[model samples]
Target: MDSLRADAYLQHIGVPRPGTAGAAELRALHLGHQLVVPFENLSIHLGQDVPLREEALVEKIVDAGRGGFCYELNGAFGGLLAALGYEVTLMAARVFGEGGRLGPPYDHLALRVAAADGSGPWLADVGFGRHSHFPLLFDSRGEQSDPAGVFRLVETPEGDLDVLRDDAPQYRLERRPRQLADFEATCWWQRTSPKSHFRQSLVCSRLTEDGRVTLSGRTLVVTGSDGRQERELPEHEVLDAYRDHFSIVLDREPQVAPLDA
Candidate 1:
């Protein structure tokens, strides 16, 4: 990533360029990204290709004022961190599904970021929706608390780390460092396979100051301090909701694909 594009990304996330890349700066960037860039899977339903390259990820998220799922969101954020002088490594994780079954390899993408100040190699993930607001200590075994929930990293006998949220297992992360290209096959599967959940739903969501707002198909759901509220939006209002809530302007609303497709 070039200096100009890096600056633009920082601006897009509403973060200032830090004089030094440190733990504090990293925390700010992580929260800023989650607050602004949504976790969305509209492209799959929109019949668009989801590329895993850095240049394409940057173009979609930064230039297009759009958001994407794990690969695109973490991929672009990792690039920005590297361009800003932080050591960023892409890591593969298998998401834990129902009945404690693990998803396919490369089911998820996360980052291990080391600050220039030598403070930490934190687990920085802005793509996982409803996750920790800040990065978790990569080396810490004890419980870490965030506004979202309590998190812990448990090391398995096999040396992989299991990420827990409020005592529930979220995913098992491999320690091996990975390249962006390594996730290509799984990324394609998520986009094209009818069995993949991303292919069955249309969702766009982002964190808000008080809580979160999401558009799942035509239903608009808002959760905050007061409580949770949900309402189905009319077809004509769908595009406006995308623009008004997510800062995403679309020519038309994306529809959910047939489950058997």
Candidate 2:
């Protein structure tokens, strides 16, 4: 993508031009992305195709005003960062699932961004909802504090780094860089396999100034920043919440696929 397209991306995420490819700009972009683009699996449930191509991903997220899971969100964000002159790499990770089991190789896509000064490569992920709100210093082995929670990257016995959120293992990060296409098979499985949560559930969520709002199936949940006073929206208002919070205008209710027997 060209610089003009990159500027449009900046506008999509509601971030102003930072004038340079520096750590500050990277952080701003990460924050803007997290605040604007949400983490959702609605398309999978809508029976919509989840394409991995950078241009299509950008069109979906930026032009269509939509949100998507890791592959779509991180894939597009990495392209924007690369277009804007940052050194960006697509990295694969294995999501930590039930019973601490690693899901699979390429279970997730994340970004490694480097400053123009060659000072650092930070873990800048806007797709991992509930992750650190800003870029986490990649070189730091110590516990890093952020608005999301206390996070740490610990080297595993097998040599990969385990990202811990509040001391819980989130995902094991592989050091090698990857192309967006490398995740195609797993992305397919995730959207169609019975064992994959995305195939059985429907969710749309976005971060708000006071808290976060989510529509899981037909349940509308609102949690405050302090994580208290969680409440469910009335059945009559659930659809409206989807439109109001997520900017998604659905012609009909999104079907939640049931777990396969």
Candidate 3:
């Protein structure tokens, strides 16, 4: 990677420059940006191939002013951290949704970044559709509070990890580091299958310094340091919420046909 251009990627994902910023600040920047940017598949539904190249991904995200599913978001952000002089590794993860089944291969891509001291690399995932805004400390058997909510990482019988939030389990992650191409087929299946949740809901979210906000289907949930609230809204409100919170334009909007769901 061209080091100068790579430095630009650091700014693209909002990882702060070490010349002034610290770890906590960098973590906050990344977490908040991911939430604000969203993790949507509108482009895919509209016939855009989520590209793998770092330049293309950055162009789409920062220039076009859009958000994307795991690959585009995390993959591009991974490039950013690497350029920022962080020891960043691309890790693969599997989703554990309501039914409690492990999602297929390449369901998610997260980052493992080591601190300057190398105490242990942290699990920082900004791509998960719904997740904590700050980096989840990798060395935890305990829960921690972030701008999003309370979260914890628990090891499975297989030694992999599962992310739990609000006492509800989310995705299970493998220990293996992954490549971007590993996720292409999985993304295709998700967008095309009736079984995928992304095919069922119109979601847009963002994490902020105080809390996180999300519009899921017809429901809008806003959580802050004080408390959180969830309420149902009309379709127009949902669309407006997407544009307002995440800056995503759902031109076809999932509400009309309900996303093949």
- The estimated TM-scores of all candidates read 0.98, 0.94, 0.81
Q: Compute the lDDT for candidate 2.
A: 0.85
Best by lDDT: 1
Q: Which stretches of candidate 2 lie over 4 Å from their true place?
A: 225-236
- The true-versus-predicted C-alpha distance at residue 128 of model 2, in Å, is 1.6
lDDT of 3 at 199: 64
Best candidate according to TM-score: 1
Per-residue lDDT for 1-261 in model 3, tens only? Answer: 466665655566565556533466557657646745777766644666766777888778777778877888888877766766677788888887567887887888888877564445688887886687678788787988975689988998999888889878888888887777777788777776777776655566666667778776678889887899999987567667767877766665655244533
Angstrom error at residue 102, model 2: 0.8
Tens digit of lDDT per residue, candidate 2, span 153-209? 999898888999999999999989899999999999999899887888888878776
Q: Output the better candidate (1/3) by lDDT.
A: 1
Q: Candidate 3: which pairs clash?
A: 35-206
Clash count, one per candidate: 0, 0, 1
- For candidate 1, the TM-score is 0.98
Cα displacement (Å) at residue 239, model 1? 0.7
lDDT of 2 at 187: 96
